[model samples]
Target: MLSHLEFSGFYFIKNLHFGELGFVQSAQGFIFLSGLLVGLIFMKRHERAGAAQVRRRLWGRALELYGWHIGILLAILALSRLMPDSWFVWNRWLGRLYDGGDVYVAAAAALLYQPSYMDILPQYMAYLLVSPLLIQLIATGRAAWVMAGSAACWLAVQLGAHMPLVALLDGLWMGGATLQPRAAFNPLAWQVIFVSGLVAGALAARGELQPRRLLDPQRPMLFHLAVGGLVFFLAWRMAITTGLIAPEVLERFQAYENRVEFGLVFLLNFVALGYAVAWLLVAGQRSASYGLRVGATLLNRLLSHPFLVLIGGYSLQVFAWHVVAVYLLRLVDWHVGPLAEPLNSLLAVAAIASLALPARWLASRAPTRLADAPQPSRS
Candidate 1:
């Protein structure tokens, strides 16, 4: 969540360039953790209510996200018109929505084709849509089958043997206007990561998963290797972003987008960097230094504190509010010239941070305690 907030705040700072310098890996962590939590929650419920109930509830969540996507888009459109410089239509993604008369139809289909700044939720909706099948596979002790299928789908995408569902939507309906036919993050390839996270989370929750590799204090080699991979990626990224090396020079080893396949380099970067983060988070949890221990103590307290737990507990509201916060901050960044630069930066931070305020309020309103306690149950 901090990474997300920072990303939104610095969307103003970065100002339309997504280079190697940006926080690229945070999206994976966000999605992976999301699926992890979903797995933890859904698997427990599945065990109780069975796969059918799990599917229904999962679909309900997807429907909620679908509504959220449309709502956020409409909200942006409504607010954009009120601005004196309502230029998103001409200057940005609003043009995609403005392209046709049957935009009503296109809007209905936003789930398949993604809009800019609003892709992750829809992709998550897609993931959750299939989660029941995933759960069934896991329940049958056939999770390897799902993993194999996910890998095959990813490989099919890599080999150009797959189709973008959005383009198919366009060709079949919507009069063949091919506007933005694929999500920026391809769900085909990324579902593997989601399923992987889900498996890890579910197993851990069930007390069947262990971080035996780097979590083991006896073996420091795996930790060093993970850290080394991260350092290498950072140095390589620096070389490219700083123009010390040409990007194309490493094209065989590393590539970006390339018409939207997550190339080998991208996957390697995610795994390597994710491992580094998990290494620190899990392995370093029990370090010997007094200051480190104190810091961890405070960090755990802050994380469990009502403030963060509130926002974390209600992922949907916080996510929707983030979309609203981001574009509003973008408008302010563009228009508020008197308070440019640093103030813009500060305001962006405040705006993104403000998402927590309402969430905390909502969470606080929940009946965490009885209206009036019964005098300690009187033994």
Candidate 2:
């Protein structure tokens, strides 16, 4: 959700600009964690219910995501129709839908056309659709092969193998309306992160990987290395963002840190940060140092706050609502012009706070809302 806020140009807290802090973004963590939770939860389900049941459940989730995607698109289309022509003219993303006519709508419904802030769901749907197979491979002791295949896909994407397929689909379906690719997040490249988390979660589920042992404070070598890497990346990020680095150098760095491709720098930074965090969390409970323990406790409490947990528990609903909020906020910006200072901050706060509405609604209907129920295991 912080990611959607960042994308929407809402920096409610200027000092803590999370989006600018690293080579990686929240989307990577979101996708990775989603895959992790799926692996952790569904693998156990697979064991109890068998592969057929697991496939049914995962595909059902994809269907749910599909409903949200189509529903949001329909809502946006309705708004475009009801709003003034100038509104669509101001928003090229919305304008393209009308410009391309029913063909574009069909493409969107078919998940081939995704507008800004609306692409992630399609990628997630793709992941969920294939997760059963990947999980099955892992369950059947071919986890290494699954990882290798995922890495190969990512490598192929890095080598530009995915573009031809995207181009083919666009040419076949979009006609001459526009020449741009539909997806912002390339699932082929991003699957490496997801599959990594999935494999980790599956291993942890089967007791092949123990979190405590992996993060044990006694083994300080890897943790120290992780800290060093985190510091280096953080310093580099600060240098670029603060203009401490020259513009030419920054441009080159940016070129290499492609988010769509899940560039090498991002993958490295994410790994470093992940290890550092895990170590900190583990040390919080097991460390001899009182200060470290206290600090970690506070951080954990802040993260595990009821409101945040509420938003997390109903992640899909909150995510869909966030996309809608971003679009609605963009529409407001187009009409009212850019909001300044505290107003923008307040708007950001309001928008983030509004996510609770859907969460609360889902919570209220929890007894019957099996789709929105909390997963068996989430970390």
Candidate 3:
């Protein structure tokens, strides 16, 4: 968004797809940072008391997430109804299920059901409900064991649980079968990333700083980030250039829609991109250049604002709102042409910035409570 407007007049920039950067990296960064922050908070909490205390505190947080989930679900439904009629259509019945609505009734009946919007909230609830077990595995003192066991559990969750469970509960129309078309965003398949985040958080809490320091800027982080990113791009490009990555798989990248369960390649690239962006952001913050300082200051302020941050914190909400806002605007009058794209991009940036304000405010009230939380044992 920032890129679109700031560089709009530049002939070379006008043709570039800045939205691709927005699509792939941002969510992964959010989730990764969420995990990192969780580690930072939980480990501190555990240090002040014990495992039992930490679990109890986390349980409360899990419940809060569930409450928030329900509220968000309701809000999505309300927004769907309030949207212009042109905004509501029966294109792909399965797509509606992705957005969180009735499965059987909507699919079989081919109806435009109210949007219940089930994505991050349900997965998060599942994660929270099972986090005690996750924490126990992480605290077991061996990184290999934590990684291996977490993988096994997450696999079990997908193969043994969510896919089958969703199938049984929602029927074939909206369950495992949907994986054929939208494999990446399925919560069942995507829990792998979430669990990976949990394990990463757990390891960080244990004072194993290798992963965090992997791109820590004080130590030539940019060089490492560049090397890593270059490697990924080369691999992807080579495969593409050689017709190695299958057409179906390559097509998925072109689909490029944002969803909770992104494909493995997309997932990897997204996280790597996130690391690159974050490292650059951090480096920019410390640079002596005036432009860097200005960029960093604005970034910090946007990230620091409480309401804006709260809205930012609830990424699912921001995404839903952004989509609705864009589509609704289009439906009202379609011929905004090339300018529409940049304008919508700018609007989204503004929305995200506004959302961060609340997040900053809420974070300010947390130091005292956070101070008392116990820390994870660091060996």
* Per-candidate alpha-carbon RMSD to the true structure: 4.7, 4.9, 8.9
Quickly count the clashes in candidate 3. Answer: 35
Any residue pairs clashing in model 1, and if so which?
none
Off by over 4 Å in 1: 1-23, 104-110, 164-167, 176-182, 205-207, 212-214, 250-260, 287-307, 338-340, 367-379
Q: Write the per-residue lDDT of candidate 2 for residues 180-292, one digit (tens) a residue.
A: 65667788888898999999998888778888888776676787898799888889988876779988888888776888788778888998888777788776566666876
lDDT of 2 at 123: 89
Number of the top lDDT candidate = 2
Clashes of 1: 0
Give me candidate 3's TM-score against the actual structure: 0.59
Q: Which regions of candidate 2 are displaced past 4 Å?
A: 1-15, 174-178, 367-379
Ranking by lDDT: 2, 1, 3
* Number of the top TM-score candidate: 2
Report lDDT (CA) for all predictions.
Answer: 0.67, 0.80, 0.52
Candidates in order, TM-scores: namely: 0.82, 0.89, 0.59
**Cα deviation in Å at residue 124, candidate 1?**
0.7
* lDDT, candidate 2, at 292: 63
